[model samples]
Target chain A: MHHGPAAELGKDYSIEYKTRLGVILFFIYLLVYAGFVFIGVFYPDLMGITALAGLNLAFVYGMGLIVLAIIMGLVYNYFCTRHEDKMNKEAEL
Target chain B: MIYTVSPSAIVIFVIFVLSVLGLSFYFARKSKSASGYYAAGGNIHWFVNGIAFAGDYLSAASFLGICGMIAFFGYDGFLYSIGFLAGWVVALFIVAEPLKRMGKYTFADALDAKFDSRAIKLTAAISTLVVSIFYLIPQMVGAGALVTPLLGFPHWVGVVLVGSIVIFIVATAGMTSTTYVQFIKGGLLIVFSTILTIYVLNNGIKLTPNEDYHKFQTIPVVMEQDKILEIESDSYHLKTQHTEGGVTFVSLDNQGIETWWSLNRSGSEPFLEEALSIVTTADGEKLYNGAPKTDGRFYQVGHASKIIRNGQEVTETGPLGPFEFIEAIENTDVTRFLKKVFEVDGNKVTVFYQTITPGKDIMKPGLYYKLGDKGNLWSRLDFLSLMLALFLGTAALPHILIRYYTVASQRAARKSTIVAIASIGLFYILTLYMGAGAMFNGGLDMESSNMSAPLLAKTFGIVLFSIISAIAFATILGTVSGLIVASSGAVAHDLMDKYMKIKMTENQKVNAGRISAVVVGIFAIILGIIFKDQNVSFLVGLAFAIAASSNLPAILMLLFWKKTTSRGISVAIMVGMISSVLIILLSPTMYEIYGLKASDAPIPLQNPGIISIPLGFITLVLISLMTKKHRATK
Candidate 1:
């Protein structure tokens, strides 16, 4: 039937590698995100610290999490695209 | 109070609605098959679908409710904003591409991919409906709140109006029309909100109270001698005055004592004054309860009571930078208005008073949580649970997940989600400014926080008010249409086509979906009117809780864990959905809804994600392990 490489599900070498990268990025994002939440809940007074330009720590940190999501998304996309190209090239070879 | 019905607003609103209806009608012809109806034939441009993602997601809860919370309370509302955006992390990294690769049309298609079990289909369909309806109520409520001020229409008028229109949109051409509606509204919402934020910055923070504010706040009282001589405030003369104890005399409004009145009565129990109220009727008549009429409709509510510019209290600070605005506001005193509704002189009157709070206090958390109350522990827990629900729910919502199928491939799905995140994140950042702008400006309404953003625009001009309100209405239509599409797809695609194996031609399938959309749209309208008073953001939090608890565990297990059985998936779905709803229903907040004391409720916390989500995961793992051997033999 000629099911493609992407359809192999959990066993294809390239797909497994991409999945690993996704897991890593997910953890990195979660660690910072959860830290911001915990700090907000437990040490709320810390959020009051005007760490930058009259903006409180909470303000800066909350914004940091949002920006981080975009950055992580870009990095994942770049590497996955590169890897997909490589796998396709190898298949042709 | 800043709201007034504008001819221009009515014009813009009609134009906006007619164009949306036009788009839906055009798409109706393009939706030829079941696939075309359900997913726009999976040929949508990734970029278009990406913006459409933003349109589908930024519901009334995000726009009106979050903005209102920030305006009325402060930074706590941004907590919801951040939590909601952070959820895309899960969606992008894990769910997006894989979900696209697996699912054909409905979300149930993805979950039922491996086992192809009717149990999974039925449970998933039921879960989709419950979550969709839960989410729909808030959007409808937000629509109702907007209608009253925009057109002087009653709440039900708005509810039924939006309900009927959205049903028509969905029934005509399911996803094609739904996507276009979302895309146009999504793009317009961001653009208009940005313009509003920019206008707020240019205006800066003005300390000018309404002209009638002083007259209403300060009542003149005349005292003749040491004996009870005379008292007149709000037209009530001295009934009788006496010195009860060793107290000599006190003056109200001593320029320092923080309260509204100063009396020169002797004793711990100084003579109490008659209550004053200010009510604005539905007919634009402003009645100072027990007093004369004031032509003003809305007095400024949340504003910097005192602004210190260059070490002196200033009348106005004009044109500050975005960073400078927040800093200057933090250094000032803000007047937070409180409203009280009571029966007086055989009439229902509402009174609003300004409480002076430090600006630093306004810019921080703990305002919304009420940490000082007897239910302090529960309130804190509930707060955490809400954040969790919002964070998890983004990856779990059926409408959101189904968007992946509208695009071409796994790669397209991933790229489109990233695009959605960028635009949506920028919009959320703008929300903080918009919320603060309304708060510091005089357009806040304590009784209806949902009016904050639109009311703020009215303060700028009637034209901007009309346009912003019209866009806000479109935002409701877009989100509701998307939710209805997802629900109808679940019913027709999963329940009818797959589970029941009802062999219908492409034409028949589209018909079934149209029927489902009509039924669900009506249900949404009724629920919306019933929950008219709840803050839309809070209702959205409950919806997130249900999605996080029910759908997330099953989807995550199915994709990653090979041992996950169909039985486990069904059990987990039922448990996650039912337990979350049951807990939410029994919580103190629901008890209050039932007209019972919060203290008398069975549970303390208002949020259900903390318990129900973990139970979903635990059930999935345990049930999967037990059913593994049986599945292997089969």
Candidate 2:
């Protein structure tokens, strides 16, 4: 009846830092996404206004959320990987 | 709409399917072990896995359903795209690393990692099976919808064809073959969609793409002091006139053929306009456009009725930029068809009449989500609930979580997720253009929105149409195979090996998994046939809701909270799964399905995520606190 993670975290010294960074980025994206659902529900007509370029707020805001997710994902990966390398190098030394 | 089977589509479809089977057979040798059969032996490269993620996630619902919805309803379908892509953020930031570090085979492996409790393994395994089957229905149904015009086969034939192919794929090589099939499908879907979007932009907006687009034969009428008068046109003979619902309709007889036309009044002048109608006579023979279904008389619909640039009206706008196309549509008027069904003298008649709607109005939330004049508070709640479920669902999906285990390390998992987000996001952006193209071009088939993307491809030429349809079939094949693999893993690994404690060799485990794949594939084919006529996107939304409610609560709590006990995890999964399914069964949409009035349903909300998701979290917290002292003493 033994059950645990199939692979251990080993000597990954950046585990604490990575979890903190992941949680923060998750909340940041959650708020942005919640704002979209909010406007879509209550102020739907406001979305029809011309916002960016020539498209309506609905189109612009919706596209903005998608682009922001991509940016945040890449940013999360870059910083997390850098920290993992840095902390593990310090631990080895 | 009547469809003609394309010979090129059949040839292309056979080739695409054969290549997929060939990949499966080639990879079969590598998956002899249980680990290889389930998770590809943790050997897939990060980049290939990333595109495979896109291929597995896109499903037929994303390409066909979303495009059709946007084509018909404008921007509401784009809302689905935005929500679906945003869910990847959850997977990338929170779930990817820990999930890869913990699980070996299935999603249940991750949840059961914290405790060796049999209840935890059983509940998690059951939840995975439930979510996978729910997700499989839409992909299988979409396969049937595509085969009708592509290979000109019956719906059941398509269902069986896809089911049998997917079964063979999963049973032969498992995750290795599924991943490669998805990688190829994902790459082709993105490249060809970009090509189709270019064609749409190149053609631009046309008031009449063809000669007969606006030629519905409008004739002016003469009246003598509101008394009997002779019509001005000698071509058509007015046979009979009737008024229903305060609108007048005249039955016209032309060369021994009779059809219905609506009367329109322009200020003080009256005119007769020909309309499209499908009639089922008392003898049970169906007619399309006042002719038999095989007559090839049914017309292709949806076009820009009016095009404008700046402040002036124009006939066409040539080769506009991406942003310019949206601006042009904003100032133009498009012809959208609306349907009404009525019975006259035991004969059922459905008429599709044209309505000229402003582009500004069409590009808003009113069409599908309905926060406009026709919508009330409940509609807004339904919209919010669906968006919430879609956002939370992706990371919780069993099939998606298992992909995190296929890579070598947690870092590869994170990188692959980013790749998925980028590719899937770009494809979604292309969907907005393809949808608008179908909306303005004469490519819409009113019967099924799932046909919109392929039908839009047909307007370019048969070669593009054949290739796009084959890619769409591959899209379905890739997704269905993934779902079957996930389900088989749940059955053989979680349910049997872990819970039942069936002492078996590695060979026996792989054999059991292959048998499970066959069973699950057959079950999916049956459900696909039963739900053949259901909307593809709507079913996908339900799958998302169920996953978000049932699986997300337990996974989040197990990872982040110290008080999450095995009892809490098992009970919460059941409560979440049962309550969500119950609420859906009692929702207004189900009431309509039962042939009852929507308002007569007890629950007002169409989506149960707003309530059921919170309920799951609450149940887990209460149960864990109650069992805390008991567990400590034990």
Candidate 3:
């Protein structure tokens, strides 16, 4: 929300918020690696199966990951903005 | 090989193009600011950016070239997809956040962050232009390739059309419009490709007996002594040789061959009988399509089918999976399938199969080796080097690096990159299926492998074909715009302003960037026209090689090395850029693609990364050490 060094450095954020955000990112990372493992092990036959005109399931999943990444960013932005706003109001009071 | 473009295809193409243009126009107003134009004002949502990343990264080579290669060759083509996806791990884990945090506008920005030197700016700018131009050629060629089947136009016309449209896009909106275009194109590419892949799985594989298919006719003719004649047909052409045997043997043209077979028809009978042909020469030389005779007189006929597994006719018959298909070929006696060659009434033709074994000379460096050999070390290494370049080059690219600046925070950069990787990974996976489907569906073109995916779509219906082709065209436009923007920024911000010391205001710099975009656009158009026939994927590989060799070393060293100087970075960039270009120009690819004499080439082979990439790092390190004393004294 606020455009300065404080936000980038995480100077104003509480430890709990930081930890929560970190956990979320970690889960996302886990999900990605899990997807890779699943594709590698579970469905080797369908790994590169062409399901559409010129695309396969693997390609679709890869694109899906990209979409999920963007959504994650927006969610992070929204939460961060709200947290910052709440903190700012408390400080004023 | 003859194709008839239906009216539905034309209408779909028009609609797709209009939609893309409309998006560009809508975003035109937001792209006025330098930050907005070059980096989308750092405001793009991560998810949209992620898909756009996939769209921008996939290019024509990934879609067309890789698929065609796989359809023709075996598992070797899929290696490219694996290598490409593997490179993203490097982007995600190593380079993403750092790159976003370091630069503001261009790749040079990141490299020049620690040292504000003119030399670094100039060399980095030059590398950007060089790599972008190299990358542009294939996209243009791909555009031309698409137009031929979809709109029935000459290759040059497609190149010109893409050039004009891309130039207009870049000159008007720069990165902002480019990103949105890529986003839209990426989404559509994935969606439509998904639909097509499902169709393939549902239809599954059907065995068409040899007797139930139309056969291609092979014709043999004598040319002027020792002369090579390229037989041209409305759809495809056959290349054959004249041996000691008489000229009655005609080789079936594999490159131009497009086999069409129906799955089920209205007739009460389940299967229909079709003609098959074979020609045997007087020299006792057996030919499937066309090969010169050795001992016996040539005999030609139709309606013959003896499936050979490995030069022997097979007794077994059934369905096969991907691996099984190859195994079947390896285990059984499948010398050749009987096919017919069309001829006018009262015309004589010869048909034979030329035993094609891997040539010993093909192991050597040059276009002859890379395109000829299947599993040789050098060929494999050539592919490896290309994969390395593509993987490493993404994070190091000036245009791609600039995307980080569009976001608000380092975390955003990291998040956006993660998304990009996922999308990119998914899309690459799809390419394998798309490519393999085209291979078995009997839609592949041996002469031009790049058209495999689109032509495969044509088998389903015209509407699907048009939409897929149009999206592919849009894919080219999105990528070219990004490249042009990066190159133009280099020229304006790094070269003219920094190296030339023009001392221009921000507004002037922005204007200069626009002008440079026009210039780069013009340059790309010229190169695209010149290199019209080469594979788009191969061209992308060359671009990757240049990027890896020139940019990667400088960026990596600057980031981790404490004592790296401006002089070292500049020297490394110049050395890498110059050496790679010189090697590639002299390599065998030039001879093959450009028709240059191999002896005349400066380098022996196509890939220079094996030597030049390391040399770039060494140059940076050594130069940094040599210059360390001067800085210490100062």
Candidate 4:
């Protein structure tokens, strides 16, 4: 089982950095997504209010969560790529 | 229930299946080594893999189930979409990069990478098999649903057809062909769904009554509770019914077929005292709820019962923007069918009577979620558990997790996941419009909610319906293939090679995988046939619950916690898989499957995620503490 270091496989990165940002963003996303579930389950009446056009709060909030997921994904990708690259460059030096 | 076969749909469907088989044969020769067969030699492009992620992830549940749910009930079905899409975030940000860097063939590879232990392999492999089998059921069920209208085949034939095709796909090039099929179908599904949606929007909301159909008058007659009385109608007596051994059996007319009606004691659904319906078609043929003795007519199943425009009742509303369209519908009247079995002329008849539901009520919550049920703890927990399972299940699904291993690098995995999220998110948005459009399309099949989307496309024309059903069929093929490939890898690589320590030749490994694919394929087909008429949405929910509870905890713990021992991971995986499967079998849904009363179920909730998932986490933590001596010795 002994060969080159396992880090060479691209698994080595700043665990602290990734976990910190990942947990933070994860909680933020869960909070928003959970909000959608809670409102629908508990406050059924609020979802009926046609928020805009014929789109009710139910539709708006759900769509918002979906759109937010994309935005959050792009955000995470950007920061994580930059952070990982910086770590790899430092590791090379 | 007599769904006439669309010849055009059959032609297109056959062509699609043939092309997919051709692609598989070509890829089969291209792949040589076991590595090549299992993971495509890790050479897949990020973009293709990303789209394939969407393809495999969407499954029949996303396409058929959500759309059908929305068409029947309202926006409540879209909640499943939000939960499913949100799961990819956990995949992309947390699981994808780490998994790709560590694992080779299966999800078990990642778990066992940290500790060279047989327990991890055995447990993870078992989890993969259980989850994949559960997932395969809905895809098979969906295949049957699509074939009923398109190919004019019975549901079981459709199940077997998909099973055989998916087995051939996996047994050939394994992941190589599976990825390409997913990529092609994933792209086609979105493109065609968009085109169908655009056509629906262009046509706008229109009230077009069925040429042959006529509404029945509800004559409320006072009758004795236990006495059998005859309420005569024009054509024939309603279908007869009798209660024997606590099961209410509605004996259909010589021409009528059996259909599952939601058996509930709660009078939430509508019922009439005198059930009378006599639908006389233009050709002087007698019909029951718009179906004849011979070839039945497609009744106006999902039409808006009433439409209001600018405070006035109007039959036609011209083309409107997406938001405006929903707004118009909110204030309008949607005539949705509510089914109830009643005695007429001493015969029990199950009539799907039209109810003019307020558009506002349809547009809001509580249609399917029962959100207003404050007193029911089980209802609240069940709803939350289903959403939780869907949210967590995506990251844990064996078919989905293996896609990361097909790519070259961790970054590729993350990028691919992001692509998947974008594509899947857009498709879900389109599903809302499609579902609502189908709801009032006046062409939906009431008996099979899974047929809602394809039947809606039928209204556009034969070509559109054919293409939609064909794409849906391909969607099932792609998903089932990916699942079979995953299960095969678990059997050949993880369980046999790693845990059993077979040390077989490369050729033998590939042979083992092929054999497992066929066996699993046959098993899936039998299950598909047994649970023929199950709603795809509910079946998919069970699959998600099992996957989330079993696989997610093990993967998350191994990645985040240093003290996570091999014993802990194995225990967590086994406990999660077993408890979830046990809870599912004991749940109310299973009680229904047992042909027993819902009240007979020992478990209050149908979903097992809330109970089993936390139980998995607790077991892992406890076991890890007990086995912490190994960590300290190291």
Candidate 5:
């Protein structure tokens, strides 16, 4: 596949940067899931505490996925715009 | 029904109305462009939009219906909460960004983005209006229900009051005021519900034995050659019988009777303390709480308390966590409960509580066809089909789909969805406790399960009762506004401007949308008043089924299926829309709504998603194949 215009622009700028962001997001999801499992297994008493009240692990993980999707979209947009501008300049040249 | 209208409830109602009107007036100036009116200029913050999503999604059905169900039916009501939250997964993962990228304002915009077809636009717009109206009925009914107890006004008065207020809100500000109102109300609903759940857990369960409660008795008499027969409480019966019956009978003892009994060591009590004691005596056999009488005398049929696992009793060593509680219930016999029924003399009195054990086939829908036996395959499939429709339908809802356009970019759309999921998911978890708390709180109005949560709050105090009820009303307003906006956008943008080729500037388009909003709001109010007595959640479920059948197939096909021509999408929408609506209108639900006998129903039941959704996809494929050559030539 061509990786699309967006992906090409990301590569030209720094593939390493995008990869790092992805890795960070993956870890965030990992942390949330892990936290819930820990609470479920060890600190069971704190499961429904009012302080932690509405913050369930499943919810945190779900929210993390949402955050990751948005970040991905933003990265994709940035690359797509840059690539489109560059392509237009090259055509003019 | 014997409720005194509290001053606080009146004040809160007035304040809410005024605040909404104020916001409407403020936004009225800015809502001159179509984008501003329909999409709030597409510049709302993700956080606000996310909460507004909660506001739009959680109507009377979510706030009142689930809670009432839980109060009356125990865990069964909470199952609805789980189902609703599950549907959000489809919206977040599957539809969020793609919808944002595709649509301008309405759900039809996304489906017809590539096609630019008049048929698609008209069909999709009509679908949006129909679904919105269906959903509005329940909210309006809920509004009327709230008014009876909260304001001491009649049900129709409540419907008209809410209808007028909502119309003003939508007509004045369009989406802008609705969004903020929803945001505020959504936040309050979550906070107050959490507080109520805390109160419930802290109070814990209480043992209310059959004794120590007042029981009312009714005596029936035959008079005037059995033509002017009458049944009344002893106090009223004496007077009526003397005048009407003109028959000398035994002296009836008239006194408010109270019985006192102790709870068994196992700690199980009758469902309703007062309701349980008035057992029906048949052939000198006293039936206590619907349980079979052992001797031909009054005996205490105490509730047996045991920690049940799966379908059998188990021992709980100590307090369990939430998930653990769910697990325990899943694996144990903790599901059995004492039920109450009331009946008259010589007839099996339905006025006693019977111990109920949900059968193993409880999870399978339509398992109990004739009440005792499990339902057959068709019924089971129908239930699954309804659930499938609900699960996938959220992403396709016109109101929900339009929310994606409120944010600026696809990334923002995705992020806002994530935030919504988190917030909504959190709130749904709270609903479980709130529902369960209401279930066991002994404050449920059995006739109307939707009153469970609010009535539960009333048990605490009128202040909380007023606030919770008001927030619940706001919940309906928020959702109704979102739906009106969606329908109006569909009419003004997709149908009138796009399909009908009406040339209009942004200002004119905005005016058209505003006018449409008023019209839709009026229609919604009328339907709401019409369906004032039906269950709100059931109505919402029908809306979901329609949304899934009519919109999901076309949306999914356009995004993923390349061969999905414009003709295919248009055909799928039309088929889905027509079939689901027709099926619902002819189904058993319509029998009651349309005042017809059950046998007169054209379809088996109201839920038609199982057959209709698949039919929509199949029709699209066949039509696309037939027109493939024509499409290529064009």
Candidate 6:
């Protein structure tokens, strides 16, 4: 049976490579997110501590999660595009 | 509680609705083919689709509900924003590329691509319809909520108006029109919210007693030898006195108008606190502030009682940065109103009295979520379950999944998602400032938290208020139309053509979709009217739980697991959807909705995500193994 995705990303860009990188980045974000939730649920007093500047840990950590997701998304796109371009040219040669 | 209909608001609202309708008509000619109607011909630009994703994703719940929650409850609302934006991470990293490559038009197409299973198509189609309806109810309820103040219409009128407009948009141009509409809405929502945030920061923190309705005036009571005597007032005469629960409430009359005031004693000094009340007599007559509803006497509430900066109580902090605004609120004493209802002498009285909450408590969790050592295990588990649902739900939403097909290729889908993450992430950050702004400014409606952001805009000026309210209406319209498109595609493409094997021409398929949109729109209006009193954000959280529990496991397993048989997929979906919905219906929240005691509910959990999500994964794995062995025996 045919396998992997139906749409071709590039001539030789590895699906395994992209999926692996994505899973790793996803797990990294998940770990950080779990920390926020853990602190919120179990150690509610900790979220009130001043984390950065004058903002409370709840505000700082909450805003941090949103900012980190955007940065990670851009980073994922940047690396995937670079690998896709290089690999596709090599296959043509 | 009192709203004066502004003509300018109605005019601006009409123009916004007209322009959105005009765009739909302009795109109608291009949506003739089934492909164009369903997937926008798979030709949307990655940048536009990305912003459109933001437009489609940020329903009235995001803009109105979260801001209101933060305004009233503080940091808990921002928790929703964090969880919501985090869900997009799952969308981008795990779901985007493969979904774009596998599916043609609907989410069912991707699921059934491997085995061409009719059972998969039917179950997925049904799940899409159920989730869309669950999501649509809140948008319609939000539409009704905005209409009452902005247009001075009844709640049902707002529901019918949004349903009709969204139906026309979806039935005419389908996804082609929907994408452009969402793009415009997404752009307008971000720009106007940023403007509102700027205004909030510029105004800074201030102690506003909201004396526009009635100034807070107290008179010393005349006492005779340790005995209580009547208080003297030049303009008001004491009319009636009733003491209940050790608090003496006296009705005071000024000319022909009357209102309730409570007696307070500090040491040996006695004073009175002014209050606002809605009284309904046994004769079935309603009174606002002890007068007619149209007396225009209800005061605008919500302002800082004391603004403390560096341990010094100040009248106001003129201008502050975004971080400074939050930091300042942390030390302030905000004037919040609490409502209490009771029947005295067979007349029902609801009194809204002032409460002083420190800014530090306002920025913490306990106001709404009930966490920490003070909260029980059930409450903490409920909070975690809701966060889990919000995180996993975004990737599983049918309307969001359908947007992946609107882009031209897998690369376009991936790139567009990054754009959505950035756009939506910035908007969520702005919500924190606006929410705090609403709290310290006189912008809250004691009756509904959904009106906080718009009413906050009113404090700036009527023109800014008009523009912001119209954009909120557009927010509702954009999300409702996207839901209808997803629903129509499920009916025509997945259920009828794929599962039933209906041999229909392109024109007939498009006709079927239009019919389905009309039906779904009417159904949404009915539910919106029925559930008008329910909280907008709470209903949305339920939608997320259902989607995450039912659809996410099936899609994730199909993508990552080789042994996921078609029968396993079908049964897992049915079991997951039923279990999540059943738990929600039986949970304490629904018991409260049913007018029963919450403690009587069999299931103690408020949210079903933690249990149902794991249940979905386990069921899928177990069923797949058994089905594989059966196939081998055959």
DockQ for each numbered candidate: 0.38, 0.61, 0.06, 0.49, 0.05, 0.50
Which pairs of residues collide in model 6? Answer: none
Candidate with top TM-score is 2
lDDT of 5 by residue, B285-314 (tens): 544333443321232222213344445453
> In candidate 6, residue B616 scores what lDDT?
87
Model 1 accuracy (lDDT, Cα) = 0.81
Best by DockQ: 2
Report per-candidate TM-score of chain A alone: 0.83, 0.88, 0.66, 0.81, 0.43, 0.86
lDDT of 4 by residue, B129-177 (tens): 9999999999999999888778877889999999999999999889999
What does DockQ come to for candidate 5? 0.05
lDDT of each: 0.81, 0.86, 0.63, 0.80, 0.64, 0.86
Tens digit of per-residue lDDT, candidate 3, span B485-515: 8888889877887778887766777788889
Classify candidate 3 by CAPRI docking class: incorrect
Query: 2 or 5, which is superior by TM-score?
Result: 2
Over 4 Å off in model 5, which ranges?
Answer: A1-93, B209-373, B596-602, B629-634
Model 2 lDDT tens row, B1-634? 7778988888999988889999999999998988789989887889999999999999988998889889988888888899899989888888888788768888888887767778888999999999899899999999999998898888899999999999999999999999999999999999999999999999899987655444566767765644325456777787666566655666677786667676666457887767777889999998776678787656777888788787778889989888888878888899887666677778787766666789997777777777845678788879988998899999899988888878878888889999999999999999999999998887787777888899888888899999999999999999999999999999999999999999978889989999999999999999999888777878888888899889999888887888888899889999998888898889987888788987899999888998888889999999999888523111
Encode model 3's per-residue lDDT on A28-58: one tens digit a residue: 6446745643443334345455544434454
- Write down the worst ten-residue block by lDDT for model 2 chain B: B223-232
Question: Chain B TM-score of all predictions, in order?
Answer: 0.89, 0.94, 0.78, 0.89, 0.80, 0.93
List fnat, each candidate: 0.33, 0.58, 0.00, 0.52, 0.00, 0.51
Ranking by lDDT: 6, 2, 1, 4, 5, 3
Candidate 6 Cα deviation (angstroms), residue B496: 0.9
Clashing pairs in 1: B247-B266, B247-B267, B250-B263, B250-B264, B251-B262, B252-B261, B252-B262, B252-B263
Error of model 2, residue A5, in angstroms: 6.5
Per-residue lDDT of candidate 6, residues A1-93 (tens digit): 122232333343656777888889999999999998888888887888888898898888888999999999999999888887787787789
